[model samples]
Target: MKAKVGMEVSWHLRMLLFISFASSFLNVSYAQTNNDYDTPAAPPPGLSNCNGVFLTYSFTSRDKEYPHIKNATAQAWAFKSSATIVNTGEYEVKAWQMFVGFQHKETLVSATGATIVDSDDFPVDASNGTTFAGGSQADLKTSIETAGDFTQISAQIDITGTQFGVKPPGVPMPSIIKLVNNGYKCPKATMRGSYNY
Candidate 1:
């Protein structure tokens, strides 16, 4: 009778141990699955669901001795540059405004195809950068059914006093360029070759 009682208690203890170990293993698996669901999945590859705006700033030429400067001792650098804005999305962007983050203390001598917003003069203060809006072409349409040039605006800007002071093959592009339109969500700019999209 004593031996039988001892065997029964031992079987009960073994069962209890097995149940505890199995439950712990199951809980760990459940927690891992729950965590996988909690995290957000990555976006699809080559997704183009949002409106797209691409800007290209090209450095045409640079002159170290700018003839416009009154002070001969002060260093003045002139740059002939052009900026192209392209709308590659499906929708039309009306009254499109662009922001140029020029950080080289440059001033705009003149600009065509786009005008400075809230300012009429060509000698706008662009030392800290400036915003531009379409002058005659104020709307950017979809790029569908386009051959060479899509719905785009090419602005030729003549600037002086860049103070960039860089060597050859060094372009004085802006630090950032963005589209400032109401009710539109712009994505971060990505570098492609020498342009930002």
Candidate 2:
């Protein structure tokens, strides 16, 4: 008779615990509904918003190499701006990294002004705390970052000298930005930036 009584008490306690959990979840959902009211509409097709972010580029590159695109264009989409505006404000619109250009034998060209010839794929480390959803801008940046940059032409490359260690790969010629930026009025050649995410 005592064991039966104990079991009944245990069952009641379990039922009470379940009811408590359900009530807690319900209150949380109710509270969050208030926060949702102030949230802006999801970013429109092009003119959009990142969650909790009014407007901003996760990363920006103001390289010294490509003078033309250096600080040429920014990447924050303005609110109420055109949906087609992927980049805006003040930013440098240099060519895409070479390895992201003609170098990678396969894969669609990244964007307009991208250098496809010397492009190479750079795999990001998911375990290294850099998170990237496939096809996101972050993914594209990874590909560009892995590509060797076009700067500081080593003497060994110019003369095939012994100083060249194992003949580090050379940046491709006819690269859209490097060539143009190099000869631009201010004469900048290559520029690069990295995103921590």
Candidate 3:
């Protein structure tokens, strides 16, 4: 009787240990799976925003006057950007200014197969060379009276450079544009200065 009782108690302890170990293993596996599923996705390149204002900018180079202006030492290039500003708050955005900064890079190859890289930064301004502004007090009040109201904005920068010349192979021009608002009202904020290209 004593031997049978001892065997029964040993079996019960063994079963309890097995159950505890299995429960711990299951919890660890579940934690790993949950973490894997909670990871976030990466954002797209060259897409950024500022205070509910989202901007999408891109750079492309081509010989607009190609073939027609054969043997031309230089070419014209265009840079463009657009934004969508949304009013998510109750207050209206009266008199808003959007400033864009650009960094231009040119990779030049000489007739002798020599290569040179040059870069410069400049601001995208209006025809009067002032920071781009929009939405008067009245316009803002009318347009953004309700939440979820939004407005569209755009900017362009045109430039001419010898780096666009096709005489030397592998010569190309590229640009990097960004928003330059130091978190202030109009006239106080300024974009990057112009470059000679």
Candidate 4:
């Protein structure tokens, strides 16, 4: 009778240990699933042009985990710009050029000291208008900034474009081209204001 009781107790303890281990594994899996990365937000408003072309610029930064770095979280920033151009004119446009500029500022704070990094006038080109129709959809450009580790990061992006219609073979270039504006400036405007993270 004593031997049977000892065997039953041992079996129960093993079963309990197995159940505990399984439960812990399930809880960890659930937490990881719930903490998936988030999608980026939409670009700000007022980044359109007078010629029915819309430009959007967005910046995002987040904390990332690095297993190799102890007691340190990596900070990363991403920048993107997209342009949608609609001819909306009576005549088809021959060519177009989109100009984009970006600036990034970063500050790092650690036990030693604080370090700052500034980058200005980084140019990105996204120009294409080989054959544009009156109501056709066109993508002008897309660009992404580098990511790194910093305590604070901020960025500014500017976008502008010029459209050119079909000109006679002998006509000068500038005379046949049209400049697009967004009420703020002529042929140039702010696609995205200063964004901080």
Top-lDDT structure, candidate number: 1
List runs of model 2 lying over 4 Å from the truth: 36-88, 91-197
Please, what is the TM-score per model? Answer: 0.59, 0.21, 0.31, 0.27
Give lDDT tens digits, candidate 4, residues 1-197. 99999999999999999999999999988978884465444434543223333333333223322233333222222222222332322233233332323222222221011111122222222122111111121222221111321111112222222212211221111111122333322343443233211
Candidate lDDT (C-alpha), each: 0.66, 0.25, 0.35, 0.31
Worst 10 residues of 4 by lDDT: 108-117
User: Which portions of model 3 miss their true places by more than 4 Å?
Assistant: 1-63, 66-73, 78-81, 88-90, 103-130, 135-145, 151-197
lDDT of 1: 0.66
Model 4 clash tally?
A: 0
In terms of lDDT, model 2 sits at 0.25
Pairs of colliding residues, candidate 3 = none
Residue 116 in model 1: shift from native, Å?
Answer: 0.4
Total backbone clashes of model 3?
A: 0
TM-score of 4: 0.27
* Candidate 1 lDDT tens digits, 127-186: 788888887888876666444244352233333435454434666677777878877666
Residue pairs in steric clash, candidate 1?
A: none
* Reference-based lDDT, residue 133, model 3: 39
**Regions of candidate 1 where Cα sits further than 4 Å from its true position:** 1-51, 66-74, 145-164, 167-169, 191-194
Per-residue lDDT, model 1, residue 81, is: 68
lDDT of 3 by residue, 100-129 (tens): 332233322211111111212232222222
